[model samples]
Target: MTAGNTGRKRPTISDVARRAGVTKGAVSRALNSGTGVSTGTRERIRLAAVELGWSPSYAARALNGKPLGTIGLVVRRSPEILDFDAFFPSFLSGIESVLSGEEHATVIRFVPDAQTEAATYERLFGDRFVDGFLVTDLRVDDERPAMLHRLGAPAVVVGAPEGSSDLPTITNDAEEAIRGLVRRFADAGHRRIAHVQGDRHMLHALQRRRHWEQAMGEFGLEPGPVEHGGYTIVGGAQATERILARSGDERPTAVFYGSDLMAIGGYSVLGEAGLAIPADVAVAGFDDIPLASFASPPMTTVRSKHRALGSAGARILLDMLKGQAPPLSTVLTGELCIRDSSGDPV
Candidate 1:
């Protein structure tokens, strides 16, 4: 229900909490990422909200000269986009934390798919709804940055731009990432390394893939079997199986997966096949999720500064909403965490 279905006064946060069987404080805590409700309860609240067609946005408030701010999150994942649990939940928490501190509102929505994700950029251009937008999952030919620049709309994208332009974007530091990971792996004495990478279509994926490959090369190790698995555990699993199928002389001694779930999936597959981790094939992952530490063998990976990414994006969006001309780009560094996966591969 796109906005026009309401003739009466719009629902209040109180009304939503009552209907969802939660207290006003619980609702506020869920919305603001404060110390409170469980993840399940929060999902229930958001889902109930979507079903009720309640939106607390600037466009809604404009009806009575009231201001209900909005920060629209645009992602280009498929309806089946798996493991969003890693990136978005934390990033959103960070974003919500910053916005709620300023007493603003946020609206999170999904696009049809890759085809429609680009078109959804038009929503930000609309006269109603959000005062600004927050874009994510950027790709190589992503057109939203340039389009937003031309339109002079307020925005903060989570990925770097392909070319230099006046668009607020926050990106991960690729070169430093490479150097750090290389040092970590070399210190472990792992010579043969492979990478199970993320979607090649995304700019972030390309940067991460390049960094991993470069780090391996700098350490005088042959760039091992790297495959572009589309940022899911299933994708990572398939890539891991392919590498393992190689002959002993052809197989990599260790593997580095793009995300934590992928690494975990690879570990599961290996365990079923009776391959001892570290002893036979070392494994590592990125994201450093809680699950990563609890995996049977405990996967080692990089901790991408996703929360900071969200915060930076929110700050930029708020600035744009305030009509400030902020720099169109930002780059943050990630930390390389070492654990049992590539255990001093001696």
Candidate 2:
């Protein structure tokens, strides 16, 4: 029953086509450029190939100068962060939803730092290991866009628009969401509001900080103290402790964390300090991860379409590989989910 049995030959494209009830050319189009074949037929062909354990030969692809039918994702984060970070898992699931049906594989490379990250991208593209890339975690001075452009690599950025590069982007409306969250706090008569931000280097973190400041000004309220939580639970707890060290009037009436995990961290600190939720200090966070709703007092946070962002970014990259021009910029909107943590909806 296995391909490793004696006298058993390897499955071929012809075999895959026969199993899928499609022509050889249809199989080729579906697996290679994704053109000419309908979506349903393409999925059928891919499923047949899976059942038959048929895979294209990389050696043959290289010899023929054909695409490798693989997409690359280079993540410059620690493995520990990836394990607990809710955003990445959901995003990856969205990417898999599209790539699995199209018979394209994803090549994920985790690097420790920027130098190795750049080198990995170059090597993957130069060696023909990937047909395109999906870039994430945009930084302040991100060089991946320009580097990939120079390599003539097809890539789509899943972050904010980078003015330095002209790469296609699939971004969430995080700024508006953060501003709205701030307004909600202000509307609830919280004059002293504090912010717990993530890494300053990340564009999203910077944007959230800036939007919080701007929104506070718009409401004629001086922005409260800001602390760097590093987007971690422990970091959030430590940051909250520092904020609480201030005198009663000097302390913030409410706090907005950059991520749900951090807000959860702040919860422990708030409880230990004998403060009541939304009574002593209200709390809100971004990225409404599953745990957000299950918290002791359901968290009020921003619900970013993380999965949609991944799916859209992958689809755009696929279109680019197929010589199609997708929209240069796609922005998805997020909703502010108000819950008990931030008090009754006003």
Model 2 global lDDT (CA atoms, 0 to 1): 0.89
For model 1, state the Cα shift of residue 221 in Å. 2.0
Weakest 10 consecutive residues of candidate 1 by summed lDDT? 59-68
Residue 83, model 1: lDDT of: 43
lDDT, candidate 1, 233-324, per-residue tens = 77878888888888867888778788887887799788877889888888878888888888877777788888888888898878666556
TM-score of 1: 0.78
Q: Number of the top candidate by lDDT?
A: 2
- Candidate 2 runs further than 4 Å off: 1-5, 15-31, 34-53, 162-164
lDDT of the candidates, in the order given? 0.75, 0.89
lDDT of 2 by residue, 1-346 (tens): 6676787688999999999999999999998877898999999998999999998887898779887778999999987777789689999999999988767889999999999999999999998889899999999988888889888999998888447457888888877777888888888889899999998889989888888899999989999999999989999999999999999689998999999989999999999999989888999999999999999889999998999988888889888888899798898998899899997545
Residue 328 displacement (Å), model 2: 0.4
- Estimate the TM-score of every prediction: 0.78, 0.91
